[model samples]
Target: MSSQFELLTTRRFLPFFLTQALGAFNDNIFKNSLMLLMAFTAASNLPMSTDILMNLAAGLFILPFFLFSASAGELADNMEKSRIIRWVKLAEILLMSFAAIAFYYELYMVLLGLLFLMGTQSAFFGPVKYAILPSLVNEEELIGANALVEMGTFVAILLGTIGAGLLMGLEQTLFAVSCVLVGTSIAGYLSARKVPAVPMENEAKPYKWQPVRQTKQAMRICFEQRPIYLSILAISWFWFLGAGYLTQFPNFAKNSLGGDSSVVTVLLCAFTIGVAVGSMLCERLSGHKIELGIVPIGSIGLTVFGIDLYFATPANVGDQILAAGAFFEQAYAWRVLIDLSLIGIFGGFFIVPLYALLQQRAKPQERARVISANNIFNALFMVGSAFSGIVLLGVMELSIPEYFLVLAVFNAVVAVYVYSQMPEFVLRFVIWMLGHSMYRVTHEDLNNIPDEGAALIVCNHVSYVDAMLLAGACRRPIRFVMDEGIFKNPALGWLFKLAKTIPICAKAKNEETFENAFKQIKAELDDGNVVCIFPEGKLTRSGDINPFKKGVERILEETPVPVVPMAIQGLWGSFFSHHGSGIFKSGKRFWSKVKIVASEPVAATSANAEMLQDKVQQLRGEYQ
Candidate 1:
């Protein structure tokens, strides 16, 4: 297990990562510089008030996501992404040049127009930014790749923002900002040139010029897959919450914390650093897989810390404004910073897996379009966040901290709804907890399980948690076949049901369940799904291999799918096993080392109960 940072050393990921990071950095630098100028110095020259101008600026920048995202997605899907990136980066260089002129001449309108164009460029880059990763890295590396990209993105945003503020304080502000903008753009273009060209996955579709129609089409494509659709919505919700918090930070610092501008920067730094740290930690936490289990953990943290932040805010407002150091000395200031940081950390945990899952599961040909739809939704959610802030803080007259409390509650509601709609998230979380907490689990030759297609996995039944441990070990989803009694256990039954486990009973006990279990197994196999069966038909009462049942043969005779022999080692005496005092009655074993070994698939024509038993026994080998 090499670190995700190693990818930065390779040409395949390094160039594109640089290009993406520099692009984000440059965008924020220009955007923030323009904002600071308007707020501090240029407000008097503008017709609208500073507040209106700032709001308008924010809207203008995000508006392009709504207007051009569909077209951008289509173009990304239709052409080689590297070529598009180069051209987009070149356009950025041109746009930034004009922006430099706008800054030099104090052409505020021109600057705003350039801002919109910058947004348009980013909108175009959004789809390819993510869609290109699958082409650059292997599936196993996708989670790491997403983590790096996310870490780079937030870090760039933070540096660029801080840089803009610093540049604004300089005597030659406009000249310095202009130079950095154009220089960063040129560097981004050069990086884009080095990115390895990726060919289109499918032939170009006929171009549609209507943004409205294309937007609907892209959204329809996104909604076509249930899991992907929910993932997009979940991601959009994150952006919504993020927008709300970011929008209020200036006021939150000034009014609530009695802090000056420097304090706002400190808060931003805490949150941004948290997200970067969390993003980097995701690869390790997920064991280099797109583990959805951590998503629930993220949501929980977001809600918990968000609410804590509300409590952390001091009720008293002093007329004296504090600088960063003074603010830190105040009561509860550290608490507020920690809350914001943890919120960002959990946000990273929430976001990375969904992005990887979307990339992994979406149709490759339409992946760009699906991502485009996600951008559109993200934009809408962000816009909605602004409105929600206006309503809550203005019309509803809620304090900033109170408003945060509302957002946290709403987050909980949204999380519950999402998990209800997609129980797989909760199920995976349970399995992930089992793997990370109760056992230090490892896998051997698990890649022998095919990436795609129907296959039958035969493993010796060691305990009630066998299926879950196996689920956490494998990358793909598996439908496990279990005896009805264990599958219907009051304690674990709901989890098994959520996993869509096929419950079976002997024909003598219940003919319908026995017959129906085979039917469901065949149906799952025919649908090109992986199915796992415990051939022993029951947990071994002793720490030894039970004789394989004939049910496996019946399954192979009907389905004829490839059979994968698997073995679970070191679980015999654990709490879930029948060994010792019986299941759940034995002494607890925390962090017990466990290994799951998988062997090459046995052909359907050659597989049988006895052969699979032998192969599994060989794989298990005395580990138990």
Candidate 2:
């Protein structure tokens, strides 16, 4: 129930948040203002067509990210970030001065150049901004921190876009932009001054200046960690999809919806607001962890809503400008707006975790380079998006709505591929669903589980889903030892396999399998991972804890790992549990409250199965 906004009150998070938001706001103001200027005022005087100019502006802005992100990443990794951020903000102020001169002189070419310069500044700032989060906030605060940052970013983008449009037609438009840009840059610089110093992991490392060499080096560093590599890919794909959506908004509004420029604002506002809402909700939904389950859910919504938007397109949109109010009058317009909003909402769900995951998992020394690699891919994806749009809409002659349909199907394919490559994503989705939908799960004394080192976790099994739920509750990865029969069940066999749940058979039923299970448990423990087992060796059939089995003693005799007793409560009557006639045949309980509580670890030398069961029993309380 704690507010993610509380982070804004803290010294570690607030300054960086303001600096990042201000930079994003300034970038959008310049970018959006130029786009507006070229389309309306400068088109007649310019040699290039408005379309070409607009696309050129966008490409120019993103080009530096491709060329310099790797170098930026290297710099961030080798030097202190607070210093880097301050310099970047100062560079922004200088660039805005040039932008002001260019705008005042009506020098379109100079303005375009300044746009790329702004992009270069952002490219250098990107890696340090993201890579600093892990050092600034504790693990428990990461999701909340990311949520606030992501939300602040979108809100800034929204405001910047709106501000650009409002100021473009004003009497001293260039003067106003000059003042605003310089003001935000100064504000951002002031914030950077307050950013707490985050030490560089590698201060002696030499910076690489060659773009190709640095990019290849960064890629090499990224590939050294599989999860980080995949997360970067997923994040890049999001940018690709986002670029497609955002770039098409103007045409979709004007041509497809037969509306004026104002309608585009309405559509964008809906999407931006939706993303803000979804980003803020992540902290609450994730229970303050880097929950990957929300990624799949977000991707699903993005694809579904994207497809629906194609269908939601009004069939008879005529060549007439509709006011914002009028645009919402049509039923399908409402549907279209809703689809856009949901897509943005799901987008937030998809993106925040990937960034958090990359930060949490990447090597400390190379984290900024990993983020730099991410930015490089993001640029590539955005460029690829432009090409894809051209091919689909130009060569194929697909309507904007039809392009949305194509992109939607492509999103589903990309998601399936990513999830297939990383089963952890899908498994987390299952756990998240079980925790959020099937039950209102709560954790108590979860911190009792050691952050690292081997621990033997013994829990009273209450349902077929208990292991999955427990995996979700505990912060560290748990190696659960489940009955072999349940492991082979067709409904959940593959899931259990993906989860790497250890399957154990009774010694009487299969001595070899049971012995092998013990060996695997010891191996996992030796690897310093948590190994969990049901002390009763099976789920309680009567909603009560069964007598503890002797297997716990045998395992302890070999490994002597710390034994942590945990209790699963309020799952006895759930569909997965042996409730009433049997399991899986009865109506399911929705949002049932389930509690998983862990007792402090007991020394393996003195702990016994019976005593651990008593601890679990007491933790279970009235539920069992």
Which number leads on TM-score? 1
Per-residue C-alpha lDDT of model 2 across residues 363-471, encoded as one tens digit per residue: 8999999999999989999999999999999999999999999999999999999999999999999999988887888889999999889999999988888889999
How many residue-pair clashes does candidate 1 contain? 0
Q: For candidate 1, lDDT tens digit of each residue in 141-180?
A: 9999999999999999999999999998899999999999
* Cα deviation of 281, candidate 2, in Å: 1.0
Which parts of model 2 are misplaced by more than 4 Å?
Answer: 206-208, 584-591
Root-mean-square deviation of every model? 1.3, 1.8
C-alpha local distance difference test of each model: 0.93, 0.90
